[model samples]
Target chain A: MKVMTLNFLTCAVKNCKSSNDSFPLHPKEAELAKDDIEINPQLLINVLPRIDWAALRTTSTELGFPTLPEQPPSPEDLQSDEALLKELHELLMETQMMEGKLVCGHCGHEYAVKNGVANFLLPSHLV
Target chain B: MLPTPDTSHVPYNRVYEPAEDSFLLLDTLSSPSETAFLSSRFCSTSPSSPSPPNFGAPLVLEVGPGSGVVIAFLTAHASTIFGTPHVLTTAIDVSPFACAATNLTVRKAVSEAEAEAEAENPSTSGQWTSAIQGDLVSPLRPGSVDVLVFNPPYVPTPGLPAPPPAPLQELRDKTTFEEDSHLLELTYAGGKDGMETTDRLIDALPGVLSERGVAYILLCAQNKPEDVKGRIRSMGTGTGEGEGWKAETVGTSGKQAGWEKLQIVRVWR
Candidate 1:
C-alpha cells in the first residue's frame, strides 16, 4: 500500500522485488512437490518422456516420493486402473506452479517462487 | 475515478432479499467519457485486424459484469436486432453475490426481450448470458470467444468502507485488491492518481483476444490519451508487431448520458 509508480510493462522484471507484484502467476516444479501431493509411483513412467526424466528421478527420490522404477512401470503394470490419469490431473492440470522453484539445467540457478508465482528470469551472466 | 450512483450496499444486503435487487443504480464515473470512447474505438473497428474465421459461432465474453447492465443492453438489443447466436457471455467477477445478481439480471432481461422478439417472429434464436466467479487474469478458453467487453472498477475513491460482517449488509466501498497499487495511489495516498489498478486491468488484454477476436479495454483519460494507450501499446503487443493492437479516443463522457466526467480511452486487438 505504500508506493512505487513504475509501469509494469516498462519494468516488470525489475519489479520482482514488490510483494504486490508477480510477473506471471504460476508456481514452479520444485516448489510444487513441497505440497502434500499423494505420490503414485507409476506416474513416473508415463510422464518420463515429456519432462526432464533424469531430473524427475533425482528430485522425486530426494523429495522422498518413492524411488522411480529402474525402468518405468510397464503398460501392463499400469493397466490395473486409470490411476495415472487421475494422478496426472491433480499434478499437471489442477496444481498451480506459482510458487515452485525450477533449477535451470543450463545455468544451475534456482529461481524463487512466491505467491503461486515462479520467477524464471536468469541473471545476465547465464546467457 | 467514477462518481457512482448508489451501491446500495449490495455486498452487505446479499443474503435474503438479495444484495443487488430492486434498485435502479447509476454509477458516476469520472472516466466514462474514456470508457465510452474506448468502447467505440474498438467496437467501431477498421478492417486491418484479421476478421473472425466464422463470425457467428464465436461466443462473446464480458468480465466484471456488475449489475449486468451492459450485457443486458447488448443482449436485449442483439436479440431484437441480429437474432444471431454470436454472443455467449461469461461474466467473471470474484463476488458470488455479484455473479448471482448478474445471472438474475440476465435472466429477467433475456426473458422479457426474447418474449418481445417471439411476438414479432417467434423463431428468433437468442443466446443467454452466464455468470461465473473469476478474476481478470484467469484463463479464458484459448479460442472460443471472439469479443471481450469490460467495465472495470473505475471508482476513484474506495466507494464504501468495509461493512461490519453480515450477509445482507449494504455496499458502500468499491475498492478491490488492497494489494493493488492503483487502489492505494488514487485515494488514500493523497490525490487523483489511482489509475494503476485500472491500468493493470487494461494491461492484461492481449493474450485474452481470439486470433481475430477483439478486446475492448475501457479506461479514463483523466491523464493523457496517448499516455494511457502508450501503456497498453508498450505491453509486448506493439501496434506493428506480429498482429497489431490499436487505441483510439472516441465519444465523450458526461452527466447528460448519466455518466461521470471521465475520458474514455479505447484499446483493441
Candidate 2:
C-alpha cells in the first residue's frame, strides 16, 4: 500500500470507529520499497488539502523517514518549493509498504500486510 | 467510447469477470449527463485552465472491484469522465485474489494510458492508490470517501457463504476446485432478495461518505430498484443540508417488455 493510503484507513473494529487513536494505523516491522515514479507536482498539490497532515507525520516517522514539518505547507509554499514538493511526492506517492503489520491503537489488532496487500478481515471472534 | 481496461490477465476462477453489469457502469459513468454531474461536483476550474483545482482531489473508492475493470476505467479516463486528471482512486475487496488482480489491472491501464498520452497529448489519468483486502467499507475512515462505486453480490441465493478466515486470505500456491468455487461465490450470491449485501453497503453510506460524497450502485430487476431508490431518498446524509438525500436512476440496460433488467442508481446528498 502507498504510504498515503494509511491516512484514510482506520481500525476495522466497529467500536474503534469513535476512538481518536484508531486511525493512521501504526506500522510495525514494515518492509518498504521505493518506486522511481516521475513526480507530478500538480497531482501532489491537488492531494495536499485532503491529506491529514498529522497522521501523515506519524506514518512517516514510524516508517523511519525524516521528521516532517509540524504543519503541512500551504499550496503556494509547496508549489514554489521544489525540494519540499519532491519530498512529499516521494513519501506519499513513491513509498510503498511492501510487508508489515498495521496495528490499531484502540483494539491492538494487527492487520498483516503481505506482498503489498493489507488484510483487514478480522477473525470471526472480533467481527 | 473509452477503451475498456484490459482484464484479460485476471483469473476468472476466483475473480468476478466483467459482464453486462460492468459494461453498463462504464457507459453510465462516461455518459454526458453523468459526466456533467461529476465534473461540476469535482472540478473547481474550467477544463481549459491548466491550474489545479482549489479543492483537494476527490477520492474515488470502488468497493469490490473484482477484476478492477471499473476502477481502472475511471482512473485511466478521469479527465474525460470527471473533467480533471487530479483524482485519487482505490479499491477494497474481501478476496485477496481480487485485491492482487485489481492492483495489476489498474497499474496496467494507467501505464498504457500514459504511453498513449505521450504520443497523442498530455496524460490525463488519475492517481491509483492501492487495492486492500477488507469487507465492504469497514476499513475506511468515516466521512473520507468522496465518490464510491459498488457492483455488489446482487444475485439472490439461499444464503451467503462464510468469508474465509484471515489465515486463509493469503494466496496459496494451489487451490482445489471447491475452494475456487467458494471464492467465486463471494463475488455474487447475495443471501436474501439480493439486497443482503447491498443493504449493508447502503447503511454505511451515511457514515462513510464525505459531505460532498456520491455513490453509483448497480442493481438488477430482482433487487426492486424503485424501492431501493425510495429508501435512499428518505435516509439522511447527516450533512443537515435540509434537502435530505437524493437518488435517481441515471442508466439502464437490458430492457425487455417494458421491464428493466438492470439499472445504475446515483445517490447523493
Candidate 3:
C-alpha cells in the first residue's frame, strides 16, 4: 500500500474506536520500496487538506524516510515551492510498504505486510 | 494515444497475464458515464441531484488486478473525461509480483498521459494509483468504496487428492511458498465450480460498497450468475423485497475455455 492510503486507515476493530492510538496504526519494521512515479503537484495540493501531517511524519520516520515537518505546508507554499511538492510526492506516491507489520496501537493487533500487501483480516472473535 | 502499458513487464512465470477475460472486462466498461454518475453521487447530498453541481473524484478499487491493465486505463483517462484533479485508483492482488507489476503498469500509463498532456498544455496534473496485496478487499474500510471491480480466479480446477503421509526424513526449514508453485495455484485455482474464491469476494461487497456504490464483476456461466445476483440482493442492507442491489448483465463475451462463459455484470444499489 502507498503511504497516502495509510493516512485514511484506522483500526477497524469493533471496540477499539475508544482507544487513543486507534487513529494512526503504527508501522513496525516496514520494508519500503520506491516505484518510478512522476510527481504531480496539483494532485498533491488537492489531497493536502485531508492529510494528517503528524501521522504521516511519524509513520515515515518509523519506516526510515526523511523527516517531514510536523506541521503541513500552507496551500500557497505547496503551489509555489517545487521542493516541498517533490518531497511530498516522493513520500506519498513512490514509497510502498513492501513488507513487515502494521500494529494497531489500541488493541496491539498486528497486521502483516508480505510482498507489499497488508493482511488486515482479523480473527473471528475480534470482528 | 500512446500504446497501452506493455504487459511483458509482468513476471508471467509468477503473475497471471491479462487474457481474454481481462479484455472482456475492459470492453464492458467502455462508457465513462458510470464514473460521471459516481462523481455526481459523491457530490449529491440528496439521492436526486448534486448539491453544488460539482465533481468529486470517485474512488475506484479493483480486486485481483492481476496485470493492472483495466485499472491503469481507467486511471489515466478518468481525469480527462471527468475534468477532475485526481481519481483515487487502487489495485489489490494476492500475489506480490502482481502488485509490483500493477504499480509499474500504472506508473507507465500515468507518465505517458502526463507527457502527452504536457505537450498540449504544460499545466496538466495526474492521478493517484495504489496497489495492495491482500485477500479481496479486507484491508479497505467499510462503505467507502465508490466503484469496486473484480476479475477473480474463476477457472474450476479439479480437486487434488489429499497429501501422502510425511516421510521420516530430517525436518528442513519451511520451504519458500513464493517459488512459483503456490503462485500458480492462486492464479487459476477456483475450487468448487469456481465459486469458492468468487463467493468470498461477494460476501465482502456489502461491507465495502458505499450506499450508492456500484460493482463490476466478471463471472463465468459455470458460477451461475442468477444465483450470485440473488445472493447479493439478499445480503446486508439488501433485505427487503424490491429493496436490494440490482444486477445487470452489462456485457458478455463468447469465448471457449472449458465450461466457462465470460460475462461482465454490473451491480448497483
Q: Write the per-residue lDDT of candidate 3 for residues A37-116, one digit (tens) a residue.
A: 76767567656754667888887777777788768887679888888788788888788887788888888998777666
Off by more than 4 A, model 2:
B47-53, B257-260
Clashing pairs in 3: A117-B133
> What are the per-residue Cα lDDT tens digits for candidate 1 across B1-269?
21122223333333212212111112211134533532342233225764422222334566656556555544554422223323344455544455555656665666565566676654232244245433453423323345566554444453322212222112223434442233222212211343545565565565456555555545433434467777666666533458466666543454353323444444555
Provide TM-scores for the models: 0.46, 0.96, 0.73
Per-residue lDDT of model 2, residues A57-80, tens digit only: 999889988888999998789989
Find the candidate with the highest DockQ and give its number.
2
Per-candidate interface DockQ score: 0.03, 0.86, 0.28
Q: Residue pairs in steric clash, candidate 2?
A: none
Ordered from best to worst TM-score, the candidate numbers read 2, 3, 1
Q: Lowest-scoring 10 consecutive residues by lDDT in candidate 2 chain A?
A: A37-46
Write down the RMSD of candidate 2 (Cα, Å).
Answer: 1.9
Native contacts kept, each candidate: 0.00, 0.89, 0.30
Of 1 and 3, the candidate ranking higher by DockQ? 3
Q: Per-residue lDDT for B39 in model 3?
A: 47
lDDT of 2 by residue, B1-269 (tens): 79899999998988899999999999999999999999999986665885754669999999999999999999999999998999999999998889999999999999988888887766689988899999999999999999999999999899998897654599776777888898899988888888999999999999999888999999989898899999998897576666788999999998784433889999998
Please give the lDDT score for candidate 1.
0.40
